[model samples]
Target: MSYVWTLGEQFEGKLRGVSFELLARGKKLAEELDTKVCSLILGHNISDEDLEELIQRGADEVYFVDDPRLADFQNETYSNVISDLINQYHPHIVLAAATTIGRVVMPYVAIKVNTGLTADCTQLEIQPETKLLLQTRPAIGGNIMATIKTPDHMPQMATVRPKSSRPLDKDPSRSGKIQRIVLKDELVDTRAKVIEFRTDDAGFVNIEEADVVVAGGKGLKQAANVKLVEDLAKQLDGVVGASRQAIDRGWLSYPHQVGLSGKTISATLLLTAGISGSIQYLAGIKTCENIVAINNDPEANIFGVSDFGIVGDLFEVLPLLTQKLAQAKK
Candidate 1:
């Protein structure tokens, strides 16, 4: 048996942290299956040092596919190559991070391979007797968790939630076999090409990457009330976040949204104001070290998972909290 993780492209010149997290989970699953952990790195001009880093993380073998066509992630090209590799290797289990790349690539590959794939899986385990990959993920807007398995599939595939686990400590001394895949002539063909790339000039803060987040929701009442949440976040030296309601109301942009449809975050501290927690929202912040909730309603579901809860109007509470934080800085 073999456990394979499809590694994603670099973010800010380093491998996305999710890649390492998947490696950590892959290591555990490989042991359970009595198999070797392997990683697929698909991109252009991948370095030997990077391959070694992957091996050190957990992979016993690293497959590197370098081609100019892979420099920018085109879904067709990436999924096609990954599907072909999976077909060839016949690994027992394959995992990918549930990032934009993985979300797009894995589904396409799954269709090509005619296999079922579980997306945004929060937990993974192998059945002791059956040896099936037990995949668990939030279902029905996060109200329930569905454990799924691809019993008859050659390679059980899943996209793991980001920040669900930490990477193993890198050991520079660890070594593994590195195989370079020569792209076949047909594999290089792609239907789509990125003509131009545009970036957000507004300086958006990715809440998923923030250590501290102050998020507001519909309980904020209106767009103007959201300023209090923003001010509080600034005082706390954190990024601002919003529930789907806030984003739909145009008080926050899509990038600032956090929940099942939004980004999964593992912040050290998540302070939410005026948000009555929904299961979908809670799923995104499951890995937060500490959650602080403030709302006027005493029965707000956000308090259920919060380390601390304050039952008071956010309009009054936020200013006081911001003031106290500012005083502490003095």
Candidate 2:
């Protein structure tokens, strides 16, 4: 039985932070199962130095399938190659980040292999007696958490949310082997071509990746007041986040919403204003290290979970905080 993690893209010419996060989690599971943690990388121009990073992060072995066809990610090709690799190795468990690529590729591979896959898993465990992979995720509109296992399948599969776990400290002394595989020519197929790739150059704060997140809820009273939230975020060099109700009110775009139905955040500091702290809303910010909330209502639910709670009007608090932050920066 082997624990396998799928690699994601690089940040600043290094492995994606999420890849290291998954590897650290995989290492713990592998240790419990007394097996090796393996990583699978499929891309064009993959270098040995990058491969070594995986080993340093805790992978016992790294599997590489370098092909020009894989230079750009295509659903059909990635799905086919991954499904083939699963069939060949028959690993006990496979994990991927719940990013755009993982969400697409893993589902296709699951269907191809006829196995069950739990998406956006919050927790993974190995059953002590049976050595079965136990996958836990939110269900029923985040009202309940469901634990699932693949009893009938050879390899239990799951896609974990990014930033849900911390990466292990890099040990330069750790070493591992790289196994290069030659993908069959017939496996590569392009049903749809990416003619051009365009990304929005506009400043958009991805709350999930933000180290500091400043969020506002419905307590601002009017949509126009959301700018206070935005202004504070900007002053702090942080991203803007909104509750589901704020999004519903059209005060902010859906991309900026953070909650169970929205993006989960693992920011170092999370500052919220006017949010009443619905259970669903709290779920998304659970990973945040420090939480500070401001609400005019002293009884607001947000105060219960907040590390520091301010009982005051957000209209008054936001401006003061923003000014203080700006002055501190100067």
Tens digits of per-residue lDDT for model 1, 113-217? 989999988899999999899999976666678999999876889998776677899988888899999777687655788776566746487687677899999
RMSD of 2: 2.9
* Candidate 2: regions farther than 4 A off: 1-3, 7-14, 46-48, 220-227, 234-237, 248-251, 278-283, 286-289, 326-330
Q: Candidate 1 regions off by >4 Å?
A: 209-211, 219-228, 231-238, 264-268, 278-289, 315-330
lDDT of 1 at 31: 87
Predicted structure 1: lDDT: 0.84
What is the model-wide C-alpha lDDT for candidate 2?
0.83
Candidates' C-alpha lDDT: 0.84, 0.83
Model 2, 211-271: lDDT tens per residue? 7899999998888998998899899788889999999998887888899889887788899
Check candidate 1 and list the clashing pairs: none
